[model samples]
Target: MLVFQLLGGDLRGALGPGWEARIADPLLREDIALAAAIDPQQRSLDARSLAARLRGLEPRRAARRQAREQALQARLQAWRRRRELRRRRLGAGLTAVLGVALLATGAMYLKTEQRRQQAETATAQREAMLAFVTGDILGQADPYDSRSSGAAGGGIRAAVDRAAARVDARLHGDPLAAAAVHGMLGNIYFAQDAHDRAITHLEKARTYALASGAGDPAGLVQVETTLCDVHRIGGHLAQAEEACASALEHARRAGPGARHLATLKLGQLRSEQGRHQESRQLLQPLLEQDTLGTDPRLRGELHWALGLSARALGDYVAAREHFGQLLQVAKAMGEDSSWLGWAYNSLGSVLVETGEYERADALLQRAHEVFARTQGEEQIETQMPDAWRAEIRLLRGQWDEASAILQRIRQAWQDRLPPEHAQQQRIAASLAWADAMAGRTEQARAALAAVPRRNDPAQARARSSAWRTLRWSRVALALDELERAGELLDLFEEELAQELPDPHPLRGETRCLRSEWARRRGDAALAVEGAAACRDSLARYYAPGDPRLQHLEATRAAFAAAP
Candidate 1:
């Protein structure tokens, strides 16, 4: 309003009637007052010039207008810069997230592709294994083939022998399948008691499985378990221990079934190594589990190992029960007669320990016949029952017959057993016992002296150790070396106290020997007491026909009081 009036050249109207009261801006009021005081006469003219300048060329008003516009423009530019910066940052963030997503997708794609390829490869390997097993391993035999000459009947053993040669040719591209086949063949050979062949194939399987990316830890467990067992039976204690430890290490990473088998195998190896107490300790936990798993063969083998451990520890009742369980398992399997025969022999061996000689004889005879008919005499399986029969004769002092049987099987045992093997040591002791009975004292001492002590000190308290010690005592008695005989018998008595129950066959035998020792020392009352104790404790269990039983009866009758 003031500017409009000033442009109209009416300063009084622009400033209003009371100009000082109307103009509120102090700087404007002061400017107007100063203009009026400069020259009142020219105030009107100056006001007119100011009004003209306000209408056209006012420098203060133009400067104020330019400063306000520049401030507003600067504010607008700052807002635009902030918005642009936010957009650029958002674009960069989005780019990074998208790149991360793409990388994740790529990784997922690669993992899926890898699994698919592995599955396909496994399928190919399984298929190739099937073809090789069917065509190369289990095919109908060729009569014209060279295996007909020496492998006897061109049997499964012969087929395996032939297939082993062609494994690299048939499954050369798939070492995993080759490992599987070799493992299978090794187990078969192990079953057949062919340790050399079994070891050859099992070692090859181990090599291939480790190198060929064998995905199944269970396969490694199986190969290692069998290899461990083969070395155990072959009397390679150190190798057996290493293989068993490896089996257990692999088993820890595998499923429960594999772990169970490996653990059981290690327990069995302990039994073979004369760590009977250790074996029982290792195996007892597996039986404590809620379930023993679904494999009948595994259950059967568990019983077998438990029986061995129990028998080694001189728990004859438990051993008999376990062997009975093994028999039931073998019966359930029906067609596995080899296992049936083994079960029979095992039970018979325990029966012998318990003085059930008649029953033991029957079982041993049956097992020997079966093994002789099926597996042949060269097999340790056949030799096992045969050796037991020899032991029975040796117990009865049928030295000639017993010595002949021992000589027959000695070569077979030596062929497979290492020089210092436990079995070899036992057989050598038995041979010395035969020499003792024949009055060849120096020869007996020489033979017994050649036998090395068991590798494990714990075995010094074992059932096998007791049996060896008993033989040494008997040899001393036969030589009339009463002092040596008394010392050895004292050791045998201590071992029997720890290992055998009352009325055990071995205990009864030791008692009879003690009675004879007393008789030789001219102690009639003590001899009568020992003879009566042996006769009373063993009368019901021993076979009526057993020579030891007859001998004990005669000795007791000789010491009886006159009527």
Candidate 2:
């Protein structure tokens, strides 16, 4: 019981209470005896002794609890260390991932910005180039219109020069734009009859246009065609032909309208070369198109070309009709006096050929007035009409008046034209004719010798040669050099046959010369027959009161009355 009480708590307190009652249970007594046998000290312990013993054991239990607490604290510290290590590793990996993401994003942004900057730069450059190219076109009046005169501050030539200078300064990198500017300059110079300057710029334009891959093919073709025209006017036929052929090929690629322009240019070139049949064939179909009538510029050009070709072919009716149409177009378009003057001159020249002298004279006078007003009286345009009028005077046997007009034209042309220029040659030829007609044989021969021979066998050259030969034949006959006269007449006839077919008006003049030669040779019957044929031919071609026909009629009468 005492042991049981000590095991429960302090033995003295337990014994005071239900110690005896607890010990009275047989199982309890047996447990207490077993405990006593194992632990005698515990069995012998009283309340005071047990209390002292329990107090002694309290320190060891406290020591063990402290040890367990220390172990638990150490384990918790280890777990915290492991958790902190894992957190640091995770943070470092996240930081690396974030840094890479930021870098990639920054690189992407920079590339995008760089591309945008480049795009903006390209757009700016293109805009600048476009502005440079279109400035002249937008800022000025029409450069090609003769009636506009010019702007308030400057004329077309000055404006074009300023624009071209700007282009050269600002548009060096843009080949296509530069090409367009050069072409514009070329047209301006060509209009002013500065052929050398025109050719220089046009050739440059063509070169740049060909080099620019993205250039407008139609525009390139137009530049080439303009180059062809400048070269043609400058009398570089081979270069003009080459340029025209190239333009034609490019025009075919451009479209039908461009091709049509190229075709017209080629036809004009052919006409200039005196291949009148080919020119007529090439241009006739285009003229017949109903659509072509609506475009006055095109119609006028076609009619002008047709008129020139027809006149060369001795188709006077067709020539007159074409010239009439051209004049109508000029009037309809409200063309300036310069254009009207040229149209009137062309029509009047054809009228002269067709023996409508009165109408021809009226038209020629009107043309002269227009030219005098528009292109100064001393200008080539005015001189041309004056020269034609002088030819009319020559045909009427007003030799002094004809000589006076020829002298004026020759002096003016010599002052203004190059020594070897075609116009100068024409003036020289005309002066020679006048001198021969006035019976100044030596002066006539000297003037003829001064006219240079062109190496080309072109129709213009052939015509000039024929006229020159006829004048030489007349001069030889006046000098009584019969053999030389016969030789010159033969040469004149050959050139006429080459340049004109039978029944041509020019052939009547040749036949008259032949009759005069036969009369000088004392072949009365031959002279009579030749004179009769010459008179009939002249009547068919010349005006009713033409002096050449009157002279032939008198010659026939003198032959018939001869003893």
TM-score of each candidate?
0.65, 0.67
For model 1, the stretches where C-alpha displacement exceeds 4 angstroms are 1-125, 134-163, 166-173, 288-290, 411-414, 439-446, 452-464, 481-563
Which digits, one per residue and each the tens of the lDDT, describe model 2 over residues 1-563?
43353222121222222233433333334444544444566565554654454344435445756897799799979977985786687886577675776699789879978666644443443344334433553356353554423344454445555565566666678776677667766776665556777788888888877887634677688888898988876667788999999999999777787888899999999987767789988999897774355456667888999999998778888988998888887675443436678788888888766656678878888888887876556566677777677767766767788889878887776655565555555556666666777887798777644433334355344335455566666666666767767776776676545766677766777787788888889977777777767777777666657666677777777767876
Query: What TM-score would you give candidate 1 relative to the actual structure?
Result: 0.65
TM-score of 2: 0.67
Name every residue pair that clashes in candidate 1.
none
lDDT of 2: 0.68
Model 2 regions more than 4 Å off: 1-159, 162-166, 335-337, 375-379, 451-468, 475-484, 523-526, 558-563
Q: Per-residue CA lDDT of candidate 1, range 1-563, in tens?
A: 32322212121133322445433333345456656644566565365564454334235545766897799789879967985786687886577675776699789879978776665555544445545554675564553465422264575446657777898787767788888778766776676666787899899889888877647677788889889888888778789899999989888777787888888989988887667778888888887672354655567788888898887655767898989989887766543246677888999888776656678889999888777765666777787886787788886778988888888778887776765666777777787788888877798878755533444475454335666677777776776767666766777786444645454655766787888888877788888888878777666455676677887777667666433
